[model samples]
Target: MQESATIIDIRHIQVGYGQKTVIGDVTLTAGPGELIGILGPNGSGKSTLLKSLCGLLPYSKGEVLLFGRPLLSMSERDRARQVAYMQQEVQVSFGITALDAVLTGRYPYLHWWQNESPADYAIARQYMSFAGVGDLAQRPLHELSGGERQRVMLAKALAQETPLLFLDEPTASLDLSYQEEIFRYCQQICREGKTVLIVVHDIRLAAKFCSRLILLSAGGILSDGPPSQVVTPEHLYQAFGLQSAVYENYISGQLDIHTYDRRSAGQPGKAIHVIGGGGTIGTIIRALRENAYPVSCGILRQGDMDTAVAMAFGTDNLVSQAFGPIGRELGEQNRQKIAQAHYTILGNLYFSQENLDNLKAAFTAGRLIIVEDSPINSRDGTAGEAALLYRQLTARPETTVMKLDELLLAVEKRSL
Candidate 1:
C-alpha cells in the first residue's frame, strides 16, 4: 500500500486501459532523496506503473498520494511543478533549439499569456550546464546523437526542478560510456535531495547505481527493496526466465550477479592467484571468493582491494604490504607468496620498471604465470628475461590468450 513517509506513494494500484488490465495489484513507493530503479522484461507493466504514478493513466483500484494528498486532487500546475516525467523515446517533431525545449520545463511557473522571466532562462541554463550540454544549447533536437538527445531530455526534466523525477529507459539506446554518464548524472541529482525513479534494462548498472530496485512481473511488483535484497536469482528467473548467480563484491560490499547457462552445467574449477595492484583486483577477488576458493594476494598498499578483502575474509592467508610502486623489497614479499600458490595470474596492467624486479622473482621461483591477451611491456630490463622463463613454463599454450574458464580448468587438472 501507499507509504506516508514517501514522496510518491502507490497503494495496490490496478491500472488498465479500457477493458484490458495491463497492471494488477501493484504497489511501490519512492522516498525522498532515493534513486529507485524499476526493472523487468518487456510487457511486465513497467511503463504502466510509470504512467500510473505520473497520473497519466487511471487505476481501477487502489490509491496514489503525493505527500498525503490524492494525486487527482492536485492542481495541474502544482503537479507539474512537483513531478517531472520523461517517457522513453519521446518524439520531438519540430526543429526546436535544445534551449527552447528545456525552457518548456518552466511552463508550470509561468502564466498562460505571460512571458518567461529571466529566472526561468537562468534555471534552464543552469540545468543545461549541469547535464553537461551547455554548448549544445543552440543545437536542434534532430541534430543530436541518440545519447546526446537523451542527455538533453534529462536536462529538460532537471530544469523542471521537481522534487521527484521519473524517467523511462533513460539510458536505453546509449553505449556503455553514455549509459554510465546518465547513471552518474541521475546519482548526482539524487544526492541533491531529489527523488528519481527510472526504468532500466541493464541489471548490473541498476544494481550498482540505484539505492532501491523494484522488479515487475506479469502485471505487478514481484520484489522491492535495496538492490542487494530485491534483485535475486529467483526473482530474475521469475521475471525473465533465466538462472543467475548473485555474489557480494568484496571491496564495495555490493551485490553483483553473473548469469548461469544451464547448457553448460557443472561447478567452477580450482584455486588460483591473481597478482596485480589491489586497486583493480576487486572483481577478480569477488569472483574467486564466490567460487569457494582459498584466494590470496599481497604487495598491496593499505587501501587497495587486497587489504579490503583480507580484512573482510580475515582468513590470515592473504597478506598486504606497503603502498608505493612494486620494487625489489615488494617483489621479495610477493615472491614468497607466489611460491606458496599453485598458479599466479595477471590482468591487463602496465608493468613498471620498479615492478619488473618483482615479476622476475615469479619467473625464477618456477611460478606458473598466466597473463591476459595484452602484450607484455616493461620499463625494466627483467621483463624480457621473465618472458623467456614464462615461455618455457607454458610452452604448449605459447600464447597468453587462454580463456578464463580454460585456464582455470588447466590449473585444476595440473594441481590434481
Candidate 2:
C-alpha cells in the first residue's frame, strides 16, 4: 500500500442551523488510507457534523481545511475530486440503473454536451469492483436488497475517485453477515490509499474493522484513537448510554463487548466458581453477581448462554471454547474449577456421561451442594453417576442441599 497523507483537517468546526449550534467546536483529522468510524447516539449531531464536512451545512465557527487548503475556497471540480459523500439510506426516488447512479459521480469532469469518455466508464467499473458490486451494474436500485443497495451506494462514492469518502451509517440496514462484509470492504478501501470516514452504531464491528474510532457524545468529542484504546467500556457507557463488560475472547484473543442490563450495586466480597452448561447456570451467575458475589465460570463452550452471561459480568474465571459437543477435556477442566471454589452449587441441569467426571471431581474434593431434583433426568441423557454422587453429598452431614428459592431466601435471611 502507498503511504497515505492527512487529507482532511477539521479544526474547531462549530456546525449548526441559525442561532442554534447542534455540534460545537469539533476538531478531527482523517489521514489518507484511514478508515475512521464515528459513533454516537441519535440526535447527537453525527449526521450534522458529517454534513458540515461536505459544505452541505454551514459552520457557525472554526475552519475546515481540505488538503491544507480552506474548504470554502475550493472549486467544485477540486472538491469533487477530493471528497465523496455516501448517505446512510439512499432512496430510489427515481428509477435508475446502478451503472447510471455511479456514472453521476463523473459529472464534475464532464462538459455540458460531452459524452462520458471511456476512462470514466473504466473508473466506474473499477469502483464497482472495489465496492463488490460490479456484477450488479445493470440492475436497478429498486431491485437490490438492502445490502446490495448499500454496496451500490459505496460504489458510487468510490466511482468519484476521491481520496476522502464519507459514509453515514453504512451498515445500519445490513444483516450480520452483510454488516461484516461492508466493514471488510471498507478496510480494503483504506488499504488502497483512500481515507474513508463512516458513522456506525455497532462498536464491535467498528473496533474490528476501522483503524480509528471517534466517539461523539454529550455534545462533544469523547474520544479519538485506535479502536483498542478508544472503545473502552467506560467510553462506551458514556457515549452510548450502555454499561458493558469488556472481555478478551478466549479463542480469538480479541476484545468483545458484553453489555449488562443491571449493575452490581457493590463490589463482590468473594470469588466463586460455577460449573454447568446448557443455559442452566446463567441465572445463577447473574444472581450471584447481583448479590455482590464475584463469580467465574468455565468449560461451557458454545450453545451455553451461561458462558455468554459470564462474559457480561466480567467474570475472571471463564474457560470457554467454540461450539461443539462437550468433550472430556472441558469436563475435566470444569470439574477442576468447581473443586477450587469456596462453595459449589449444582444447577438444575441433567447430567451426561461426558460430564460425569466433572461431578466426580467435586465428590473427590468433598465439595457438593446440589439443587433439588437435579439428578431426576440424569439417567435419560445426563450423568446419572454424577447425580448419584450429588445425592450422596447432600445426604452427608456436612453438605447443604436446597432449592433455588430456598437458597435465595437463606441469603436474604442471612443479610438481615
Candidate 3:
C-alpha cells in the first residue's frame, strides 16, 4: 500500500544453487491488486524464481527493484517490511505454539530485546482468524496437521502486513477445498491492494482466481499474460508436455482445462472439415482432435461455443461475424476446406436462417459424415428449407450417418 505504481520490478535475473542454474533471464513486473500465479512443470524453476526475490537466493546477474529501489541495497528488516514470504514447507522446532510462530512476523518491527506488544498480538490473532486458524493459536505447531500448519503460516505472512506477498507452491499439498479457500483469500487480499505472487500447480484453480499468470519452462518464462491468454493448450503443452483444451466455463465464467493423453491418437491421422455453430458440435470437434484427425472448422460465429472449441485445439478455422448470416466469400472458403479434407462432418447443428449456408456447404465434400441425434423436422429452423436439404444429404450414397461413438470407431478403424 506504500509503494509506487509498480510494486516489484524484476529485471533479467539468473538464480541457481551452486553450479546449476535453475532460472535464467527472468524479467517481470508486478503492480498493486494483482494475483499473479507462477506455473510450470516440475524442475521449471518456479520456486527458484521466487527465492531469488527476497534475498533467499543470490542472483548472479541482473537486479531486482522493490518500490523502485535496488533490492540489494535494502537491509534485512527493510526487505522483510516490503514483502511477506510463505515458503512451500516450514520445519518448526517441537513445542512452539502457533501464536508464537505467527508472532515471528513481527520481528522486523521489533528491537533485539523487545517482545511482541499487545497490538502485535491483536494483529496476529486477527490474521489467524482470517486464515481460519484462530482456534489453533495456542496449539503447538508440531501437533497441527500439514494443512493446519500451512494456514497458520499464511496467518504469519498476513500478519507481516507487507505490500507484497510471495508464496511458493502454497496450496499444492493441501486438500482440494483448502486449496480453493486459500486462492479465494488471495483474490480478496489483492482486491484490498496487495500484490501476491503464487507458485501454483493447479492450472484450473489459477485460471479461476488469479488476475494474471506467468508460465515458466526450463529456466525461462514461457508465457505471461492474463489467465485467458496464458492458460491455452499450446502454452500447457509447451510448459508441461501435456495435450489439453482450455475454455471459458459458462456457469462459473472461469477458465476450464481438460487434459488428454497424446500417446498415439494425437498424431495427425486424417484431415476433416467441420461445419457447426450454436452450442452444438463442441464435443464432436474435441473428439476429432483427440483422435488425431487434423480438423478445420469454418463459419463459426466469433463467440460461438463451436468456435471456442475449434480455437482451443489450435485447429484451422474460417470465422464469421458473431451475429450474421454467413457471407458469400466465407461460405465459399468453407466449401473449399470441405473439398480439401478427406471427409467433412455435418454436426447436429440446429438449422437457422443465419447459418443455412453451412448446411449447403456439406454437399461439397467427397465423403460426408452426418451426426444426427434427433429428428430433422424438430431441429429445422429455416422454415423447412434445411429439412429438404438434409433429406437430400442423407440420400447421397457418399454420405454416412453415424452416432457419436460409431463415428469415432470408424475414424479409428480408417486410421488403422
Candidate 4:
C-alpha cells in the first residue's frame, strides 16, 4: 500500500500558528529521487515547513498537492500511506520493544483492533537491519542509548516504505559518523527513486549529500538550487547573518565553509598587493584580509587554484590568460597595483618564464615582503634564470624576507 514514489506541489503556501505567520509566502515542488535539504537559521521555519508538508501542521493559505491530489482532502489513512515522517523528538512508552515500536509504521493498513501481521514484523526487521539496529530489536526503546533509539526511529520510518519521507534533524542525537551515515542512507533510498526532504542545521553536511538545497530566511525562501548555487557566501549571509568563505576544497573536492567575524578585525588600511601563484596565495591573502588589510591579487592565471581562492575571498584579481605568457598590457596592470600598494607580498611560487613578469612587477612595490615558505632553488622552473632575479630582489634595501608566520605577525602587529 505504501511502495510508490510521489511528487509534491506546494503553491504560495502560508503556514503559521494562529495570527503569527511563520512561512509568509513559499512555493516549491519536489519529485521522486530528489533529496532536498531545508536549511536556515533558527526560527526560519525549517521544521514548521516539514510538518506542514507531512500534514502535521496545516497551511492556512494556498494548497499542497501530493501525488496530484490535494493534501487536505486526503484521508488520514491515505496521507500516512504516502508519506513517512521522522520528527526531532520521540517519546515512546517505557517498555515497548524496538521491533514493536517499528511495527507502528504498519498501522495504516490494519483494522482498528488488528495486531501487526507477520509481514509487518518482517518489514520491521528488514529496515532495522538496514539501519544497523536489527540486533537491538528485542531491547526496550527507553533502555536504548540515544544513538540506538535514533536508529530505531530511522528503522520505523524506513518500515513505512512510503514514497515520500521527511526527516527533521534525525541525526541530532547521532555522532559524526552516524550523522553522515543517515544522510548516506537517505541518498541511497532516493537513488532507488524515493523522495526525501531533510531538515538539517549542518549546512556543509547537507551540501555534501543533498541533491538540492533550500535556504529559508525571514519566513520566506531565500535561495533554492543545487549546493554550488545555494550554499554561496551571499545566500548564507542573507539567511544566517554570517560572513562566510564558501569555497571548493581542493584536497577533499568538496565545498568548504569557514565563517569569519569582522567585528574585532582591524580597520581597513592602505592596500597590500599579493603576488600569488602556484597555490601559495590562499593562506597569505586570507591572513591579510582577516586582519582587515585591503589586499589585491595579481598575475594569477585564469584557472589556477589561486584564482579560485582569490574569488572566494573577494580579492581584486589582476588577470592574465591561463598558460599564456604575460603580455605588455597585463604586465603594466600588475605594476600599477604593485606601485599603489603600501606593501606588496610575493608568495612562495614556482618561478617560470611565463610568470617572469610577476617577479619583475614585485620590484615596483614601495616596500616588499617575500614569503620563503620553500627553498627558492627547488621552486625555480626557469633553469635558474628566474632564481637570479629573485636573488636580486631579496638584496634590495626595501625588501624584507620572512617565513609565513613572521609575515603574519608583522601584519597583525602593524609593523611594516
Candidate closest to the true structure, highest TM-score = 4
lDDT string for model 1 (97-138, tens) is 889889998888889898888999999999889878889998
lDDT by residue for model 4 (1-416), tens: 33324499989999999999999999999988999999999999999999998899999998999988999999999998889999999997988999988999998889899998889999999999999999999999999989888989999988888989999999999999999999999999999888999999999899999999999999999999999999998998888888788889888888988777655675776799999887998887777767777889998988788888888888888878888789999999999988888999999999888998899988888899999988889999899888899999999999999999998887777665
**What lDDT score is found at residue 46 in candidate 2?**
89
For all candidates in order, the CA lDDT equals 0.72, 0.74, 0.89, 0.89
- TM-score rank order: 4, 3, 2, 1
Which portions of model 1 miss their true places by more than 4 Å?
1-4, 264-416
How well does candidate 2 score on lDDT at residue 199?
91
Lowest summed lDDT window (length 10), candidate 1: 311-320
Q: How many backbone clashes does candidate 3 have?
A: 0
What TM-score does structure 1 among the candidates reach?
0.66
The better-scoring model by TM-score among 1 and 2 is 2
Instruction: Give TM-scores for every candidate, taking all chains together and pairing residue i with residue i.
Output: 0.66, 0.71, 0.88, 0.95
Q: Which stretches of candidate 3 lie over 4 Å from their true place?
A: 232-234, 243-251, 258-263, 408-416
Show the colliding residue pairs in model 3.
none
**lDDT accuracy of residue 410 in candidate 2:** 47
Residue range 182-277, candidate 2, lDDT tens digits: 888788877878888899888888888888988888667999998878877788788777767665554675677766644444544445666667
lDDT of 3 by residue, 1-416 (tens): 59579999999999998899998899999999999999999999988888889988899999999999999999999999999999997988899999999999999999999988999999999999999999998899999998999899999999999999999888866899999999989999999999999999988888888999999999999999999999888888898889998888666888879888656664576788888887677887777777777889988988787887788777899998887798999988998899899888888888888889998889888999898887899999888899999999999999989876787677666542
